[model samples]
Target chain A: MNSTIARLTATGLLRGWRGLLLALLPFVMLALALLVRMAFGIDPEITSGLLDTFNLDTVVPLIALIVGTGAIATEIDDGAIVYLLTKPVARGRIIVTKLLVAITVTLLFAAVPTLIAAIVVTGAAGTVTWAYTVAATVSGIVYCAVFLLLGVLSRRAVIIGLMYVMLWEMLVTGLVDGARALSIQHWGQSIAAELAPDAITASLSLPVATTLAVLVTGMAAWFATQRLRSLTLAGDS
Target chain B: MTSIHIDRVSKWFGHVVAVNDVSMTIGPGITGLLGPNGAGKTTLLSMMAGFAAPSAGTVTLDGDPTWRNEQIYRHIGMVPEREAMYDFLTGAKFVLANAELHGLSDPGAAAKAAIDTVDMQAAADRPIATYSKGMRQRMKMAAALVHRPSVLLLDEPFNGMDPRQRMHLMELLRQMGSDGRTVLFSSHILEEVEQLASHIEVMVAGRHAASGDFRAIRRLMTDRPHRYLLRSDDDRRLAAALVSDDSVVSVEVDSEEEALHVQTSDFGRFTVRLPRLAADHGIRLYDVTPADESLESVFGYLVQS
Candidate 1:
């Protein structure tokens, strides 16, 4: 991966409203954790529920969606990507560098905040705090890879990504037992359950969840690079 | 010297054909792609820059296919028509990023040279978002030129520039052409193309309309049937007198408009002889206006020709 492209992608991803949105999500999560700690006072049920329902389910995917799509989609939309595409650098390298930046941003804004929030709500760094942090990290990577591909593939990436997060991850995976096998949220939960058996439980086995997460991330990254390689200049003749 | 060979290339989008079976060789020089709006000039440039693949045939740089070939970019520096760029970065940072992407040994030095070439060093440290339209355009040129590729493709590079910027860019392009770099810029303005390019390729309605030097294009435009609305004190006598001239093809007197609609075979001869013949015959000429003088009409005539 080219460092210059990665640097540029990182700078663009964190600029203007996108940076504000990314910064705000983590701040909101941390604030909610602090509020819960003051109200509930170190209860295991409230801590686990907040980490699982609010942090893992809502905050992680949303942060991933923001940074992942923001890394490349805005450039593609505004026709600014032509400058990067015309260079001697490989398209695959560019996509990889962009994905790396997206994943890094996801980790910083999503996973690190989850770690801080878990500790904040629980009043300690225990199995529960570490469990959700690990889960958020892995899920952030997977979600970033998928959404970065979406950014390259569609102009309406954010809208489509929101549908997947709300409908598929939140609604369908929560309802259907079989859907857990294909869900990124479930994969994170399964990994979390393995780490903290008392606080978290997962429908899918850890091995299956781990394998799917790895497979999906690799496939999404590959497809994104391939899509970028064949990108056309925007606008009509 | 680098040369781009478009071998019967055609590009279509869904049901619309943007570029149709165009074949041309652009050698080391400033070759203007001249056409009116919607004439597929951008489409052809897109294919040449390797940003779009042709639906049929090939675009090659000295024999290597440009499509899907990242190596071709090492020789191509493209200034796209689109104004969008990494506006958050300073102009120096943007050009440096481009130079680094090109794997230049000293990106800072290259970026400095490019920014200087575009005469943007005073404002190079400012964020591109703060730049005016012309400044943004010049920074874009700096980014494209940072790598110093042999082939430069600019699409309407003078669109937002004032007269001074246009002249500066024209001189730079001329210098590049003389240096044996293959520079091709697209423009619809006749004077712009006439001023910068020694050779030109004209496109109209997705088809190659004409190709030659400015003088040759001028001749093709002039050689087409020249139509003029002539209002004279004695329209009947003028029409009758004009009929005897070898340059005058046909003359019809329109009584409603009170003028002679004259179609001439030779533009130069007719323009020279019209007033002389009118003075000799003592038929006072009140008005002489060329009816089909629009650029679109000239392009249409070229397409048909």
Candidate 2:
């Protein structure tokens, strides 16, 4: 991976109001966790419900979508990517580097905050916090890969990504039994259920979820590189 | 010396043809791509720079296909027409990042040298967002020049520059041309190309219209059939006298407007002979406006020729 691209992508992602938006989600989670701890008083079931429904089901994918699409989409929209594209560097390397930046941002903003918020709500160390954190991190990688590819392929990546997370992953998968197998949130839920069986429900087995996660992440990243290879810098026609 | 060869290159988007079956060899030196706005100059340059592939032909640098060849960039540098760049970083950081992306061992020094070459060292520490349009254009040039590639392709490089900045860039391009680096820049203005490029290629409506030395192409543009609207005290008398001149193709009296519409075959002779003809005919010429002088018409004539 090229460090220069990585650095630029990171700086670009963090400097705008996008960075503020990312940071705000974690603070909101922390504030809610603290308020719940003060009012409801150290309930493990409440913590599990809060972490699973609020953090994993909501925050992780949202942060991943914003950071993932923001990492490359802004550059593509502004036509700043031409400087990087017209270089001797490999296209695959550029994709990998940007994807890594997206994943890192998601983890920092989504998973780390989930871990801290779980501790605040539970008031004790347990498998629930670690389980959900690991699940969030895994789901974040998958979401970032998918959304980064979306960013490369479409100018309306953010809108498309939002629909995927809200409509398909949350709404449809939550209501339809068969659709869970195709959902990113279900894969994370399966991993979480493995660690803390009583905390969350799993539709697919651990082995199947792990395989699908790895396959989707690998394919999305690979497809992104292929798309980037033949990207057209269309003039202002 | 490096050369970019576009062999029978044509690019079309959906149904609109941008570059049509155009073939040319841009060898070492400064070559100006002169065309009117929306004449496919940007599309042609995009294909040469490997930013877009030609639909029906090939663009190669030194016999290597530019499309899907990342290695070709080692010898090619491009300054795109768009003005958007990394706005948060200082110009120094941006150029340095470009140098590092090229995998130069001494990226810092190369970036500094490029900044100095563009005469942008004074504001290198300033954020690019704070820069004027001309400064941003120069920073774009510095980034493109950091790797010191053999072939330089720029699209509308002088769009926003002031007079001094334009002159400085022209000098820099001329120096690069003399050093045997192939520099090709696109411009719509005739005087801009005439002042800079020793060689000129003209495009009109997606077709390669003319090519060669600047003077030859300039003559071709001026010698096309020129129409003029002449308002005189005696329109019929002026039309009668102008029709007798060897340079005049046809003269018609517009009774509604009370003017003479004269089409001339020779621009130089007709412009010189119009006033003299009116004076000798004892007719006072109020206005003599050269009609059909738009760039499109000038280039449209070349397409037909």
List lDDT for all candidates, in order: 0.90, 0.91
Show pairs that collide, candidate 2: none
Which residue segments of model 2 deviate by more than 4 Å?
none
Provide interface RMSD per model, one decimal.
Answer: 1.3, 0.9
Proportion of native contacts in model 2?
Answer: 0.77
For candidate 2, the chain B TM-score comes to 0.98
> DockQ of every model listed?
0.67, 0.82
Error of 2 at A40 (Å): 0.4
Q: Per-residue lDDT for A17 in model 2?
A: 91
Q: What DockQ does model 2 achieve?
A: 0.82
Q: What is the lDDT for A66 in model 1?
A: 93
